[model samples]
Target: MVNWSLKAIDYEVYNGVTVGDLILVFAILFIAFLIAKIIAMSLRRSLADKMKKGEIEALVKFVYAVVMLTAIVTVTPILGLNLTGLLVAGGIAGIAIGFASQKVVSNLLSGLFLIAERPVKIGDQIIVGNVAGFVEDMKIMSTIIRTYDGLYVRIPNETLFTSNITNPAANSARRFDYTINVRYMDDAEKAIRIIKNVIEEHPFALKIPPPRVFVDSLGESGMSIVVNIWAPSSEWTDVKMDLLWKIKIELERNGIQIPTKRNLA
Candidate 1:
C-alpha cells in the first residue's frame, strides 16, 4: 500500500551513510537474512532422521548466525564504510575476545562435537557428573537434564564432553543383576534352581543370551545367589523391580530362607 521502493535519492544528510544507501543496505540485509533462513530450513530437513530434533535445531541456529554474520560483514563495504579499517579492527577485537573467552569457545566446540557424535540425545536417560535423568535439550553452552526427582539440571558442554556419561538406554537391550542372600543352612542348589526357574518365566527377560543363576559369594552372613538377566532396554527398570519380587516370592514358597539379618553367633 505504501511506497517501499527507493528512487536513487542520495539524500546524504549524514557523513557516512546516505538515506538511499541506508535503505539499500537494509533491503540487502533483509534479503540475506531470508536466504540464511532458507538454508537453515534446508539443513533441518536433510538431517531430520540422522539427529535429534534439539541437536538439529541447535545446528540450524549456528548456521543462521554464521550466514548472517558473513552477510553483514560482506555487505557493509557496499554501504560506504572503511572496509580495510573495519576488517583489521574486527580481527584484533576477535583475537582479544577469543583470548578472553577461551573456555567459552571450548565449550561451544565441545557442544558441536557432542551433536555430531550423539553419545546421548533428547529423551535418553543418562548419568553424567552428579546429574542423572533424561536429557531435555542440548545447546551450544550447556546440556539440560530433567532429573529423576523432577528437577532440571544444566551442565556445561565442556564438562559433559569430558565426564563419563552412562546411557542406560544406549543399547537395544540391557542386563540387570540381583544378589539374593540365603542362610547358610538353606539348600544352595535348590535356591539356585528356584531362581533360575523364576528368571526363565519372566515375560520381559530375553532368552537368546540366557539368564545366569550362580553362587556369587559366601559371606559371613550367608550365601549370595547372583541372578543376571537381560531384557529390552525400555523395560529394564520395570523388569528388575517385578522380577526381584517374583524371585523372592518363588524362593520363599520353595522353603529357601533368604537371610534378613546376620546370624553372627
Candidate 2:
C-alpha cells in the first residue's frame, strides 16, 4: 500500500523568501550599481586622456551602456528572473534592433575606417562634390564642415566614401598656371623673358623646380604665353592672385600691350 502523507512530506521543501534576505538582495544590487558607475567614470577618464575628442565621446557612451547592462544582469537573479529565458529574449530583441539599424551601423563603421585611415583630418580643407569647407568635427554618422561663408554643412559618411575628395593642402608644393595674351607685334621672346624674371623674383615662388614661361600658341587674337610657377601650398591662392596683378603691372610698365577685342580683327 502507498503512504500518501509520507510522500507529501518528502516532496515538500523550504524555498520561501524572507524579509532579511530580500533586504540583503536589494543592498547588493545598490552596491553593484554604485561600483559599476565608479568603474565607468574611471574608464572614461582614462580613455579621454589617450583618444581624440570624438572617439572619447563614442567610447564613453559605449561604456555607460555596458555598465548599466551589467548592473541589470547582476540584479536579475535577485529578482527571481530566469537568466536563460532573459538571454533568449534579449538575443531576439537584439537581432531585430540590429536589422532596423543597419544603415546606422554602416555609417558608424565607415566613420571608424575614415578615422583610422586619416585621408582627411580635422582642420583640413576639403572639397566634396560642390561643398568646400574646413573639417570642423567628425562623428560616427556624419562630418561637420565650416564653409568659407561661415555656413555649417553636415555631410554623411557614406557620401564621403563614394565621392571624390580634393585636398588642396595635402602637399607642401603646389603649381599655379596662368595664360597671358599679348599682341603678336610685340617682341614675344622679350615678353617671355620678362615674365620668367618676374616669377623668379617673387618671394613666395619656389626655386627648386624653377618658374617656366613658354609660348603656348598663336591664337586668332594674339600670341598666347603660359606662365607656370611652383610655390608652397599654403601660399597658393595669395601667390596666384598677386602674380597675375604683378604681371599685368609689369607688362604695362614695360610698354608691352595686351591683346584686345580690336586686335582680333
Candidate 3:
C-alpha cells in the first residue's frame, strides 16, 4: 500500500541522470519535433508561391534540423553525459567512430556546397559519372535522381560532388549529332538537302545556330553523311526523335536509301 510518485523517484539517480530527467528530456524532444513540424508547415504555406518545391524543401529541412539540434544540445546537460570524460575514457573507440563518420561528414559538406554552387537544380537532366537522370531532390547526405526510364536512384553527395557532372540543360540550346549512311549509288548531296529540310520543319530546331549536313566520310558500305542539329535544350529529345526518322523517310521518298549489306553488294 506504498504510494509511488515522481517526487519519490527524484532521489534515485543513475549515472547522474535521474528517471525524471529522462522523462523531461523525452518530453522536450517530443515538443521540439512538434514545433519543427508546425514551422515546416507554416513555411510551406507561406513560401509555396514564392519558391520552387526543391527550394522550399531545402529550407524546411534546414530549419527543422536546426531546431532538432538545438533541442538535443539544450537537453544534453540534463542527461548528465560527460563528453570530455567519455572521450578520454574511450579514446580508441572515439577514433574508430570518427573514421567511420568521415564519409558522413564529407557528404554533409558536399551537400552544402551543392546548395551554394547550384551546378544542377531540381528537374535538371544531368549526367554524373556513369549515372544519367533528372535531379529529383538534393538532400543533406544524398541526391535523388529519377532516370529516363523512371527508376529511382540515390547517390551519395560525396560521390556526386567528386564526379564529373554534365548538365546539357543548363544551356539554352543543345546539339545532337547523327550519322546517316546512304547507298554509294544514291546522291549524297540530295540526302543532305533532305536532312536539312527535315531539321528546318521541326519546331524545336534552332535556326540561329543552323543545322549542318555534310558528307563526313566514305564507309565501306556507303557514304557517311553527318547531320548536326541545335535545338531548344528543353525540347531537344523530342526534336531528335521527331526529325531523325523524318529525314530518313524524306530521303527514301526522294529515292535515297540507307546502305545495307545487300544494298552494298
Candidate 4:
C-alpha cells in the first residue's frame, strides 16, 4: 500500500525497454530465424540427394524442427524473457511428452537400428509372423508392405525388431524339392531318368548343381521319388509351378503312366 502507482512509474523509467532496443531484438530474432531456415533447407536438400527415401526424409524433418526450436530458444533471452523459467518449463513438458510417446520413441529407435543394420531393404521379400510381403517403404515408426494378393500392410518398427524375419530372396540360389509317386509295378529307375531329364530341360533350372532324383520312400499308395533341383531365387516361383506340367507332358509322351490306387480288402 506504499504508493504503488508511483513505484510503477519509477520502475518503468529505471529498467524499461527502449523502442530502439525492441527493434534491435526483433531484428536479431528475425535474422536468426532466417539463418536457421536456410541452414535447415540446405541440410535437407543435401541429405535428400545422398540418402535413400522414407526414414531419411523423416530424419531430415526432425532435424529441421530441432534447428527451428534452437533458434527460438537462442532468441528468447534477447527478448528479455526469463530463460531459466523457460528451460524448467521445457524440461517438464519434455518429461510429459516423453512418457506419453514412449512407444513412438521405441519405434523410432528400432527403425534407426533397422536402417543401420540393414537386415531388410526396400524391394526385399520378407515374412514376419503371418505377414508375408515385399517391403514397399520404411519410416521411423513403421514399414509399408504390398502383399502378393494386392493388399497393403503397415507393420510397426518395434514389432519388426522383435519378430523373426524370413527373407527367402536374400540369396541368389534356392533349392526346390518335388515328390513324385509312381505305381510299385512301374520301373522306378525309368521314372527317375525321365524326371531328371525334365528338370534338366527347364530353362530356369541351374545346370551347375545338376538335378538329383532319388527313391525316398515306398508307401502303400506307390513308390515315392524325391526330385531336388537348384535354381536362381528370382525364378523359384515360376520354376516350381511349371515343372509339374512339363514333367506330366514328358511322362505321357514316354508312355510312363502314374498308377492309381485301387480299393484294398
lDDT of each: 0.84, 0.78, 0.86, 0.77
Arranged by TM-score, best first: 3, 4, 2, 1
lDDT of 4 at 79: 55
Residue by residue across 1-265, what tens digits does model 2's lDDT show? 2576445534423344444445656776677668767866775666453346767667557656666677677766655667887668799888888886787767766776776677887888899999998989887678898998999999988788667999888988889899899998889998887888788889999997888899989987789999889989778889999989998888888878888877546
For residues 107-165, write the lDDT of model 1, one tens digit per residue.
87888788779899888999997789989977777899999899999999999999999
Order by lDDT, highest first: 3, 1, 2, 4
Clashing pairs in 2: none
Residue-level error in angstroms, candidate 3, position 221: 2.4
- Give lDDT tens digits, candidate 3, residues 187-256: 8887887788888878888998988888999978888999899989999899889888898789889999
Model 3 TM-score relative to the real fold: 0.69
In candidate 3, stretches whose alpha carbon ends up further than 4 angstroms from where it belongs are 1-85
Q: Give the TM-score of candidate 1.
A: 0.67
Give the per-residue lDDT digits (tens) of candidate 4, residues 1-265.
Answer: 5687545434432145444445566776677667766766765665464346665666766656666677677666545667786668799888888787888878877887887677888888899999998999877788888898989899999999889999888988888888887777678899888888888878989887877889999888778889888888888888988998888788778766666645221
Q: What is the alpha-carbon lDDT of model 3 when measured against the actual structure?
A: 0.86
Candidate 4 residue spans exceeding 4 A from truth:
1-57, 63-100, 262-265
Which is the leading candidate under lDDT? 3
